[model samples]
Target chain A: MNDVYIVSAGMTKFRKHNYDEDFRLMVKRAFDYALNDADITHKDMDGSVSAYFSDHIQGQLIAGAMTNDYIGLATKPSKRIEGGGATGGLAFQAGYEEIASGNMETCAVYGFESMSHLNTWKGNDVIALGSDSNFDYPLGGFYTAYYALMATRHMHEFGTTPEQMAMVSVKNHGNAMHNPFAQSPMKITVDDVLKSPMVATPLTMLDISLMSDGAACVILASEERAKSLCKNPVKIRAIGSSSDTMRLSDRPFGKVPLLPNESKDDYKNLKYPGVHSFRAGRIAAKMAYERANINDPLKEIDFAELYDSYTSAEIQAYEDLGFCKYGEGGKFIEKGYSEINNKLPVNPEGGLIASGHAIGATGIMQAVYAFWQLQHSVKKHLKNGKLQVENAKRGVIHSHAGTGAYETVSILER
Target chain B: MKNDVKGTEIYKTDPLIKRWDYSLSYTHSYAQDSEFFKALGRNVLLGSYCKQCNYKYGTYRKYCMYCGSETADIELPLKGKIHTFTTCYYSGEPFMNDVPYTLILVEFEGIDSLFMSRLINKNNTKISIGMGVMAKFKSLQKFDVNDVYFIPEL
Candidate 1:
């Protein structure tokens, strides 16, 4: 089968519009951008789907209906897909699966969210709502608390300091300054992150990703059509997905990638012994490199868009995804390993940490940036006043929702 | 004397009037999300089983789905292992403010299934996943519909 290609990708600036502006309006903007980027019209061939976390958004079920009606994809074999935080990636996976399986020639994945529909606290309450309501939500252990428990474990064992955790915020916000779509863009210091108010011990307000309203869309097609119709066609090298128990408390900490039951218990904060969010990337990247036939991924891949819902998560993912050795994530960032000009540029698009977390949209948004980079050399774009990953021939996009409970890893190549 | 600083409130009358009044209680227990814990009230811990693959889903699903099989409901024993947990300092519900409580996802022993429940013992102890637990139900007077917890088997 021919390769699946990302012909066009674009996103609305991730910012909170009034609640009066609902999902439909948000997606109309997203469809306009994606279709423009793809250089096609809604009348173009094939089907479509909208990926998102609907239970947390407006409780109105069949959110896809809102999107389908807005983009008029209703008659075109549409449905909604979800996997908690990985919902966007899962949606991309389904759309890609359609093309790979020869069901459709082209598909569009629209992800939109209106967090202002529910304030952060209310939105969090809603996210926890779909979880085991009888057991966890009643105890008030939602997303923040789940990560807090992991932070406590990381500290107890690895000597990973809150300052180091705070560094994630400092580093991410620093990257956000260069990002146009980021909600909170400012130059913050480690001291600022540490001095910032503590939302949870070991996790300050700066440590978590923001809940902002936004939407993003990506148009995927076969390579032949992409090369002919689009300015650039970013190939879908590989996509990886994995799920663990509901909460970190239910998983056993693993010592190796996908090799569970290893001896050490350093990351005991996890309930499952052998799984990690980064492991998803490991599998995805391995399959990606294998499919693309590249060895030495660290050297071959020039840039990365890591899912940075929390700064600590990005650091941990650095180790888990084989970008750096374990425990060196803190050091890697300290020395600027993830800096735009460093060995590997991570979150050049301001990551979930820099830009606000838009749930289902982030996974594809990250991949879209990789699409831009693989097609347009970062060196060329950076000079053109765009955030660029220099000389980027291949790149990886990582996103995880709800701590490490669900993760999606995607790789892109030109 | 300490004075509580409070904000002013606006009150207005609406043109519509209602004649009926009703009382309904919304319970918050962070412990149960499905029939599993309520199953504990009947001495059975319920888990979701995939009819397609027979793989038990640790979390609940509206559709009993796996690779292909529809999921079915399965009954499990009350005893499970306390897997991992987080103690919440804030509560969305006011009742929880009385005590900062721990919410845990317990992987039931002899089964690789997980159930979200409260970690309760006669005496307070550090909560962890490996801690053994069995279903314990409080009297209906204190039931709150969420009063069942994983109490020390002793």
Candidate 2:
């Protein structure tokens, strides 16, 4: 199989657009930027894929066909992929495979979500469709409630405080000040996070990611094609995806059964053992690491772009991805390890928190940010003396959706 | 070119309005889900057990996820413990009227899977993990998933 490489990456500013600006125009602009960045024309592309999460909000279906047509690539082989928030990751994976299998020398992959067209509640309803309709939707369980359940349980079992969760928002918001493409770039403090309106118990409004309108694109090529067309191509080292039970209730918490003759020690030790476990993420990370030949993620991985849909989710990712031991995520962030200049910088582009979540575009946007960081192209975008990792060789981008049910982990190396 | 028409001659009309009313219905059926709902009407919780792999699912499943063998149905006790819970301060339209309500995930003693329900008397009682609770079924003219809830165990 041929190796896959990302030759170019581009994204639109992640924020609300004018009422007249639609997804087609957004994607066209992003595609143009990517082609220009790669120093290649559309003639080099053999196929394309579009990631669109929900058509309900757009009031249209067959978004992939629309995008491909608008970009004048309708004759080429094209398709659409969706996995809620992991849509971009899945689309990227598909494009990579197309090149790796030698079926196409180069492919264009893009993700976009035009969510600002709908009202807040309507958009929320569309997003809540990610949950199980029979069980979760009937009971009014949306993303906030589902994540809040995990946060509350984590606090009860691991002594993780709401303040620590607030720190995640503070750090990401601070980092956004340097990111020109961020949606809401405000220097917020932990106190601001605490004082923010509560969306769910133990989860303030700042703890959640924003629903924004944006588009992102990346051009993937075979090793031979990349060598001939572009310099500083980032190799796609490994990619893995994993899924769990659809309903949150079906997720395993690893609760030990209270056997009639079992010792008290066993009961005490087993109580709430997996309350904070992100089973899908752990599975995906393990698979990706093995394929990428990375055993020590915290040491080997120079930077990371985690899906911080919620502050608690990011804390859980630290443990799930084996960056630290279980229940040590809160303390790990407290030590300033995940800061921009720290040993392992995470979300130096501000992550989904301040960067804004454009659903389908988020995962690909993470990859785009990672590409810039690894290539040291992020220097021009930074302001206020923000530090970038020197000699950055490798990075990981993780994305998940459906209440932690679906997870994708990709490893990229310079 | 000189304008010949005055401002009063121009017609001011209301914006065009289009009422688009659409409804979608889905019919989903699985062996385990059918059995589970049937048992719900009788106020009994049904779970699936795989004799081949010794794997048990608290929610009904037609086939074992591990062994792929058809599982047998078993009735689970109503008593369980709160595994986790959260109170919603904001929610979607369907749940807007019931804001500030507590939703709980209950774990039965012998089952591995969990059951999600709302606490009926959340205002009068404080909620916490590991607290004992029991399932309470509503006497409804029509049976639905919302008919079941949880209350603090006596």
DockQ of each candidate, alpha-carbon based: 0.16, 0.44
- How good is model 2 by TM-score? 0.91
Off by over 4 Å in 2: A253-275, A381-387, B1-32
Highest DockQ, which number?
Answer: 2
Clash pairs for candidate 2 = none
Per-residue CA lDDT of candidate 1, range B5-63, in tens?
55433332342222222334667543434565455456555566665655665544435
Q: Give the alpha carbon lDDT tens digit for every residue of A1-414 in model 1.
A: 657888887777777543445678778787787787567988774888787786536556778877787777767888788777777877888888888888888888888777766656656667766554544555563676666655555454445677777767776787767666678787888888888766544567788788878888888888777777687788887776665555443343344553221234644454333222345545554555556665665677788888777776777777666676555677777777787777987877677877777786777677666777787743342334356766678787776666555666777887
lDDT of each: 0.66, 0.81
Q: Which run of 10 residues does model 1 chain B get worst, by summed lDDT?
A: B12-21
TM-score of 1: 0.76
A124-187 per-residue lDDT for model 2 (tens digits): 7768888876667767756788889889988886788889999999989888888888997879
- Highest-TM-score candidate: 2
lDDT of 2 at A98: 92
